[model samples]
Target: MSVDEVAALSLTEVAHKIAAKELSAVEVTEASLQRIERHNEALNCIANVNAEDALAQAQKADERLAKGGPVGPLHGVPLAHKDMYYRAGRVSACGSKIRADYVPDITSTALKKLDAAGALEVARLQMVEFATGPTGHNEMAGTPRNPWNTDHITGGSSSGSGSAVAGRMVYGALGSDTGGSIRIPAYCNGLVGMKATYGRVSRYGAMPLSFSLDHVGPLCRTVRDCAVFTQVIAGNDPDDPTTSREPVGDYLADIEGGVSGLRLGVPTNHFFDDVDDEVREAIQESISIYEKLGAEIVEVEVPGIKHGFALGEVLGRVEAATYHSTWLRERPEDYGTQTRNRLMQGFYYPGTRYIEALNLRGQLLSGFTDEVFSVADILIAPSVPMAVPTIADTDISANQGFLDMIARFGSCTRPFNFLGLPALGVPCGFTGNGLPTGYQIVGRSFDEATLFRAARAFERETGCTENAPVL
Candidate 1:
């Protein structure tokens, strides 16, 4: 297959092809490297490309396949990830200048699992400094550009993951979501990203912005690809006690089961308050699509949802501040303007307020699920409330507009993080500006399978996943 043909296949498709011997692992890896070499200069999405090591691994994968031993589901696939997941003896910059040279002795559980699954780590992708920003603006490391429109923002902290995958540079990439890091980028870049329920995946060896809100997940071109990736990385880990002991479900088993007889809730509250008209129209159209797919669209009230964002801010900032206290005290100069400023606020949050926020999460989650999920199997909302903004417009400075825009970026996504529910962002349509916009479907904790099923149904009906940025 040609390089473009190889790049065009979804992660799952490429994996199948490699296993079936239609494409050698070396050919696929070389194609991915070619795309990165050609496009990374323009998009600024790749932090560091491990060309030699990746090619060597790909050769080994092919050799193993030739031996006819049991092959993993992700056998011979190439993937890049945000610059935060640690691999023993390798640097994990976490998109910050402070950690640019920081190498860890421990490999992240997620990466280890992916390595075991026969996935190759081709590159380390760029991200917001310390995973603190929503707008993919990393001053120390260059900001990643959206592939769809080079001048626009790639909603971040998973900035490069979104850019690389949507730009067709890599099959898939792991993205960590804390306050919508994964979903926002997915929305802006027109890919599917899932922020699984907190504890659904282990966070060991991954950089942490917020202990309470941090979630590790994947950003992929399609929902099925996302499902397969998530399936590989998810499950209990002995190293991270926070990981849930709950059995991981087969996300792909019934992904094509369709949404028949399912109740999909459209919020009558916070999700639409300040949403742009174009975005609202796209979401409504998606709801109509769901209604046509044998799913019931119900208007449901989300009780106590208004406080979610603020409470999440309190808990998140405190946790973030606690994590960075030492760095903020020393080597503060190394941090970027926006990340340093954002992390600084975490210190000022009163202990009482942080405690209160933590205290309210379970109460709010219980009330939210009992009231909303009781009436509907899933809740659908805009992944981002506004159209994708220009990089120049959202570049962080001492501007009130920048703050408002950043806050708006996370408005729809952070709530789910705070509530610790599983949320998946799927491309719904394009906005007036010709940029992509998406909707997120939220499900009860550990219920990612249903979210996948519903998203797959929408994807199948609308064929929205067929659109990709012409990088």
Candidate 2:
């Protein structure tokens, strides 16, 4: 197959073909590498391309398969991930000057799991410096451009993951979400991105943005791709005690089961109050499709949703600030203006207020799930409420209204991170600006299977997964 042809296959498709011996792992890896080389210059999404190492790994995969031994499910699938995930003896820049050459002595458990599953890592994609910004504005490491519209933002922290996956440089990527990092990028790039329930995946060797709010998940070309990827990485980790002990569900087993009897809730408040007409129209159209698919649409008021966002803001910033306090005091100049200024505010927040914010999370989550889930199986809301903004328009790090822009971009996503619920961003349709926008299906904690099923149902009906940016 040609480079673009091979690179364009979905993660599941590529994996199946490789397992069937219809395609060689080396050929697949080379095709993906060629796409990265062709587009990385314009997209600025890749931090480091592991061409030689990936090829070597792919060759090994082919040899193993030829030997007719039992093979892992993801054998020979080529993937990339955000620069933040660590591999021992390798530089995990974390998209910052502070860690520009920082090499870790331990590999992230997430990477180790993927390695065991036989997936090859093709590259380290760029991200917001230290995963601070919501928009993909990294003055230190160059910002990634949205493949759909290069002038627009790819939505950040996982900016490069969005760009790389959507640009077809790689089939799937691992992205971390502190406050909508994964979902916003998924929304902006027209991909399926999941921020699984808090503690669903380990965070042992990944860069820390907010210890409490951070989540590890996958960004992929399709919902099933996200499902299989999530399965590989989900579960308890001895290295990270925070990982959940809950039995991981078979995400792909019932993904195509459809949403025939499901109740999908639409929030009547904060989620839609600021949404653009184009985005709102797209979401409504998606709801109509769900109704046709036999999903009963219910309008429900999310209890304390606004307060949840406020508390999350307090907790996330304070946690991030605490982590970077030493560097803020000593190597302040090494950080970008936005990241530095953002982290500085954490230090100023009163300890009592921080404690209160931490205390309120459980109360808020219980109240939210009790009220929201009683009426709906999963809540459907805009992943990003506004029409996608241009990079120049949102490049407000030095501007006075930087916080407002960040808040606007994260208005729909941050609250869930605080609530620690699983949310999936699936492409519904595009706004008038020619950029993609999507809705997130927020499920009960650790109920990622339901989220995947609903998302897959919509994906099948709308054929949304078939759409890709014409890079």
Candidate 3:
């Protein structure tokens, strides 16, 4: 295959080709690196590119394949991850000036799982400073330019993961979601990103944004790629006590299981409040495609969604503030302006309000799930409720409507985080403005299989998964 084709193959396709000996892992990794070298400077996605080490690892993978023993599922797949996931003896700058030079002594459990699966980590991707902001801006490192249109924002804080995967710099990436970190980027970049059911994937080594809300998952080109990668990274981990002990399902097994007869709920409230006409049309088009695939689309009311969003913001700020109190008190100058300003808001949230939010989580979740799930199998909503904004348009420093833009981007997304439900944002169509847009399919807690099944059905119907940026 041509280098371009090698670079553009989906994660599952690349893994299968390598295991079949049709392509060497070195060739694939080199192709990915070459693409990164050619395009990353323009995109500003990778914080630290590990070409020399990745090539060496790829060569070893080739050697292991030559021996003809059983190989792991992702034996030669190349990937990059958000900079927050730790690698012992290496600096996980986490897109923050404060931790820019801090290197951890222990590797993240998620990375260990990927290592055991034989996937090669090629780079550390940029992110929102301290994973605080919703847009891609981070003064500490640099904002990742959206490959679709360099001027547009690649939603954060998994900005680099979305930009890199969409730009074909890597086949897949590990993206953590607190609020809309993973799904927003997916929606903005026209990729598949899953915020697995909270605790479905361990958060052992990732930097915490909101301890109760953070979820670790994958961003990839297709639902199948997302499923394959999620399968590897998920499951119980001793290092993370919060991890669910529920056996991870066969994501690939029933993914092609048609969504026929499955009822997908369309929220009758909140989600469309400020959504652009083009975005709503595109999402409606996606739901129509699901109908053609034999799925029943039902309009349902999701009461208390607003409460979930408000509560999520309160909890997120309080938790992040708790984590950064010392830093905010000592090295306040280190955080980016927007990040620091955002974290500082938490200081004023009264202890009672924080506890009230926490105490109310169970009731809020029950209200959300009971109303939505009782009526439909999964809830579908626009991932970002508006047109994908330009980096200039959403720049917090000069932009007069900072809070408004942030709320628009995170509105439809943060509620799921509060409820601890899994949400997958899959690219469905492009907006009239030509920027990509997507919808989020959310599942009941630990019901990732159903989400994947629905996403795969939509993916197969539209074939929109094949679109790539011309960068």
Candidate 2 lDDT by residue in tens digits, 1-471: 788889889999999999999999999999999999999999999999899999999999999999997788789999999999999999999999998999999999999999999999999999999999889999998789999989999999899999999999998999999999999999999999999999999999999989989999999999999999999999999999999899998998888899999999999989999988899999999999999999999999988999989989999989999899999989999999988998887888899998998888999999998999999999999989888899999876555588888888899999999999999999987888999989999999899999999988898888998987887
The clash numbers for all candidates, in the given order, read 0, 0, 0
Worst 10 residues of 3 by lDDT: 396-405
Model 2 TM-score on a 0 to 1 scale: 0.99
Q: How well does candidate 2 match the true structure, expressed as C-alpha RMSD?
A: 0.9
lDDT of 3: 0.90
* CA lDDT, candidate 1, residue 292: 92
Residue range 68-145, candidate 1, lDDT tens digits: 987899999999999999998899888887887999999999999999999999999999999999889999989999
Off by over 4 Å in 2: none
lDDT of 3 at 340: 83
The lDDT ranking, best first, is 1, 2, 3
